[model samples]
Target chain A: MSGDERWIHTPPRESATFDKHAIAEIHRAAATGIYDIRGFGAKRKVPHFDDLLFLGASISRYPLEGYRESCGTEVTLGARHAKKPITLRIPITIAGMSFGSLSAPAKEALGRGASIMGTSTTTGDGGMTEEERAASSLLVYQVLPSRYGMDPDQLRRADAIEIVVGQGAKPGGGGMLLGQKISERVARMRTLPPGIDQRSACRHPDWTGPDDLEIKIIELREITDWQKPIYVKVGAARPYYDTALAVKSGADVVVLDGMQGGTAATQDVFIEHVGLPILAAIRPAVQALQDLGMHRKVQLIVSGGVRNGADVAKCLALGADAVSIGTAALIAIGDNAPHLEDEYRKLGTTAGCYDDWHEGRDPAGITTQDPELTRRLDPVAAGRRLANYLSVLTLECQTIARACGKSHVHNLEPEDLVALTIESAAMAQVPLAGTNWIPGKGGPF
Target chain B: MPTVDLATAPVRELNAALHSLQPSTNETVWRVQNPRGQHAIAVGLDAPVTVEIDGSVGYYCAGMNKQATVVVNGSAGQGLAENMMSGRVHVKGDASSAAGATACGGLLVIDGNASARCGISLRGLDIVVKGSVGHMTGFMAQAGNIVVLGDAGDALGDSIYEARLFVRGTVKSLGTDCIEKELREEHRMLLRSLLDAAGLPDVDAAGFRRYGSGRKLYNFHIDNIGAY
Candidate 1:
């Protein structure tokens, strides 16, 4: 005390455990008598792709010439049981976003962009939209618990089928399409009132566990004459166990969505507190495939917080066959654009911070059901922008692959990567920078 | 009358034969003997043909049928006449579950009982069950008419939409937003037509009680928690 008595002035410091954010949340909950519900992924900082650094070719490996030696980005998904497996020209695909949460035009734009790039787009909970079906050459139909707008004819026409076990943003939680966004078309398809808040069941009504899922897959196969591939999509909480079960259940492809993936609406507490980050989720999912001797045979698609091509290449290096984008795609189609900064400010949030999709008053017209708001987004123009973004991502991924001396994007391995942080080294199972030692997984035996 | 023994023939051959026939083909009446509880019998038939399954069929019988008339002599496993666009599927025996699920347009006649989730997510399909339906029948149904001649199990028509449900017998419990609505002259007429289409015109439409969405839980309200 005598040493500190010289001149020490410390301002009021908030509690580290109960900071301002936590206090504000407590106040909000106390006032509302309910939990905070919001859209988007986890906002809290966690170990991510930036923590891992790629070790470019220097001595032991030879880099491919960038000018002519083309790196193949093509991938074939669901070739195991389906007669007509989806063959993508690129290793990037669009993640499932429901028609209820997104406007019809936004769904169309996504389909157009995917078709232009020779990739696949997915239909989420509410059902398949006519616009999406008309625009997309390859469409993956989702079999969700609610079975809203689910038709066997649509299943037969789909290029692939995705059985969504759980989503990454809220692993065990159900989906919520607020009353404001439930338009006439959305209400008709889901069999609900036009202005009602519709909640989807977390568990499938007919089937319970993985064993039942196996029988369901067989039923779907018979329904479509084994033409379309079956994909089992799971959140990344128990990637090891879930991936193993999905493979055993006769899934041709496994889509692992990490906690960083977006949602239309969920409890804000569940979003930040539940599930694992994509960076930590990939290695374990790959390990399950390797154990079953189905690695690369049963394709794996990782999703959550994928922004640029570097992230995609990193995912492939970690043994993912492809990567899916949801929030990034919305951004590509002018979501949260600076041009709408004034409108966003009027909504009480800035342009880059506008994630209140559940409000149904989106200025960019991507996430609203209002006809006037939706009119702001021209599908043709938005689709071109999305295509440009996808092209840029592909080019960046190719650049990274070429630097790693890989002829194909799938050939990029974990050996060409190092971790910048100890946490990433442990989570991603990669060696630390400037060292050949991995903390938990010992080196060379 | 051509006969295809399903027990000996591969499913692909049988489906291929059904798929190749034109809508106007006169050789439309085909008989499938020894179905032996096989799945997806006469699926994806766009032709205006008639397929007669002589034995019990497994899951997804007559799935995605368009303009095809399918008659099953025995019970169906699950998802009978699922997503039938425009056709008629007649089942002599009971249907396991999800009978006439998500069909946009069709007439599904279940001579015997239908188990749980019967007519689940049904969209514009007209289904008439001769016997009782298990719990959660007509759940989340969009735009269709379901007629049950016998008692309904628990939570009938839970979260139902525009679909109209008519139960001749007592319902154990009504689901959220599902209430007993008055059967007016127009409703009786509509039910009479549906019953006639399902080949059950002898049944009295006045004996049935109409049930539909109460529209109370449509918008979110704190007081509506008990409804859910």
Candidate 2:
């Protein structure tokens, strides 16, 4: 007690490298002999959109009245080659979250919410669900490596098709759906045993590389009768190269997912260590597009840690045609709710930190496949909540755009942004705040 | 039978023509000329029509075919009959890599040798390679049967799930979690039927050895760490 009391008086110092969390993780690894697998994105704080601030119009530039003036948020995707392109009222779209990872009601809610906002919702690894298809007005079908539930009929019925090359949470890794979540319905869809741990392949079984991808895209186009838009989705590993390759492969749209993008289940190390931040990726992707003279021709959709309208506006300014949201959408529909604190505590977690989605025991009824917990979420109510959140995001983006004197959200350029930090200035390709100096690009003082 | 010359018209036009056919259309049979290796020929056909391509074809020949029977009379390039939904795709000559890849339904009868990753990710499709198949044949195959009459290359049926592999000849090496299983009567019957449908009714199903998932890697465990 004397020795402990003396140490407590001076205040215990925690090592930055080996903090409490790291020590616990080491002990856990030593005991379990397995790497920690969890849901959600990187928890580490990286250079993000928060590092940039918008410059409000002043004496030199006039600000439009937010209440009176209008700011256009509408965006069109997949216009390059497809006979039919998708037009959305807002630039915010729902990212791919598999029916296997999420409850059917949650999938329906996502579809309903996106439909309410006049945007698109996407199908994930396990395939398109009947409920999601019926609920969503515009749906994008994902062609993942597993090809689970990949039906030609569904492909024909889809508004767009996204070829998933990699996921942001684990760029070079495959998807893992623990046996706990692989219910009978999910198993049937994926053509697997009901309770087996499903591992999706990292690469497509048929084709390899950009040259092969070109032919694959052509095959998809042929299959859809050139009717549906074809999108190429890549994790933010080599955005510039990937964007260029996607363009060369005849993609109508390129969907870039950054490190902060969430996954249903992956190794925690892979989630935190791999992939670049969205802030560092968007500019390079845009540069590639611009270099190819395919900047707006082949649309780009950015995802990962995009929380509010400012992030949306920032993404659009950085040359992304739209922004897709996964984690935020789940949060909007009441995932990790504070009201479920008791349930979270039971799961050995807190409300905001409950990321054990792979366990399939989500108290909010969003991530779990357990019937009791799933029944807790009413699709209509959750859908309405998601729609409300999406509306707020759109409004917030418009507010920023209007204040910057831009008639359209797309008009908000790099000139309207300044980085609060040097790292952000270089990554965002914008000047530092209170100075004309850009880290890489020398500017007038 | 109506004939379409690919040299004169683009593959797109031929595909468009094929797509234009309805279920009740009188054009029940069609022929393709100009043996050139063009990609995506006779793709996305949703009718019960029979398409006979007289020569070699390139990548994704008869891809996503539904109801239609596409007969490639010569050697085929990559991804032959990929994602075929129904009907049959008969390749007369040696086929390139990933033959019948991810096809959900239908029968793919390759009369000649098939290259690497043959029938990879097969989802309920029945593939009968009369000759040999190249490396990694039937990798991660979810459902269906791959009946190889001749030898199979390395890593056959790697990480396979539910799919049945019946090989009459030598297998180079079995992939992880894949093992030889007893050729039971039910399997013999299934193989017999597939062989019969592949136009090899006389081949004895008794001569073939079956391989499938050992079920060890189905659930992840630290003990199976070396396999990964």
Candidate 3:
């Protein structure tokens, strides 16, 4: 037999468990002696919003007029306790991405975009920036375990406060900002020396448990004079218990982030394996609120892998009062634009596959601290693009709501949804398509 | 002096009154009576005023204090003077856990012994405890000075970063990445100043031992896995 024919007859076999990517990761760890760290969320496919489809109106359900009927998308948060509750024209909001993780202009663009869409923008671990505060009409300041640059004046300046209990990307882990991103300004804000790998504390220094957290909440209220709302955010590990505890600890709102939530930098292992998917987390969280007789009283904001209007509509239908976006928003603001593909290739990544946010070499200028890279992104144009994206998402949500025979987006319920796969049916607690079976809810085949 | 009794008025009213004071207000001296160990008493004071609390205060007393002097006649509960900025907080009696936690700028003086985790995550805050401090004191402290005149409990200055810790008495143990260092002239001067600020100028700064980070664990390394 010829050499080619002999090779074809006995082709090499590869193990499924140790695939090319897995082999490459092992080789990298062996060479570097450190686990791979990257940005963005879980890249592995899982049960998500795409598995669920809306059951549009027919003879059984009446549909609203497509063009003439108006579908409301307004949502009010922090109405349970705070004197000043935030009212948003749309249910979608910009999630917390730190100034250090992202550039200053990116933060300003987020604020501007959220303001134009009449939604709120959130601050992250580093601190609140003056530019962000001035740009956004409504801002939510996060009180993280690090307390880095946490100031009382800024607390009072914020429209709302979010107490970050854990993050979805690494639920039990703390934040990690590598040395490359720790510029002079970032170091000054965090009170750390420039060009050092900063590791934030996993647990809060002062309070230990929920009882102590209750007192801490009281202290925050006293600090703000009860004028601003307090939101308790938790990674989706034990959503039912966390939601209950958050409410019991006197939170005005609860933000649940799933495993697919983006982080600036984290271990690849943690990003893929830590918490529950957003689809599986929402039902349990909603049940907890419902059991406590606070389903809508204390608003629920679901996040993690929220892509388009369908994801927003699905989240609302599954009982979330609102949805927050991070990775998607970054993309809308030119994070991985095709025009920068050549630059991305030089960084050993494609445009859509770039996740080295911690390296501070982003071509799109959204996640870098380099002045030259940062100057490439015009805040006004990026902000306008984000606003347009947000507008489209709202319109698409309204169209879906109208088709579901709902006058308001909040009126959409679980009854208007069906799961295409049994795994999604079990996770989302929705009936499987073309069948009356909701896997764990007990229906005959 | 304006006197507000906690028994008569809600804590909210007292905080509101404190918050309403302007920077140049003449009502700079105030007295808080009948605290009854209530939580969040006299918290979030921004003006350059002096607040004197008659009774014991509960959790987070003088938390997030700015440009104010808060004096507690009685003992303080957990997280006293937490995140204080540009001010002074003095506790006449013993302090519970986590005193002056995460305070960026200010001076925290405890006349009596302090419980575990005192000055934890201290950021540029000068803390002086006249008596002994409990275990894990100055744990993960980034930037600050913790001076204990008496003995220190186990694991003193665990995972410390840039924070200087001085103890006059014997330390039970040193935490990971924390090591005793030579008490140089500059450190002695700093200790003396901190002691003077804490109202113990008579104490000898030379008697104290200095401890700080070993410059390890600042950046993650695989060789340091055992310490972690």
Model 1 off-target regions past 4 Å? A1-9, A151-157, A188-193, A222-225, A434-445
List TM-scores for all candidates, in order.
0.92, 0.98, 0.97
Model 3 off-target regions past 4 Å?
A: A1-14, A442-445
| Quality of model 2 by C-alpha lDDT | 0.93
What is the lDDT of every predicted structure here?
0.89, 0.93, 0.93
DockQ for every model comes to: 0.37, 0.81, 0.80
Off by over 4 Å in 2: A1-9, A442-445
Residues B71-131, candidate 1, lDDT per residue (tens digit)?
9999998878877788999999999988887777879999999999998777788999999
Q: Score candidate 3 by DockQ.
A: 0.80
Question: Which docking band does candidate 2 fall into?
Answer: high
What TM-score is obtained for chain B in each of the predicted models? 0.97, 0.99, 0.99
**What RMSD, rounded to one decimal, does every model reach?**
3.1, 2.2, 2.0
Summarize candidate 1's per-residue lDDT along A3-22 as a digit string, tens digits: 87756977789999999999
How does residue A176 of candidate 3 score in lDDT?
85
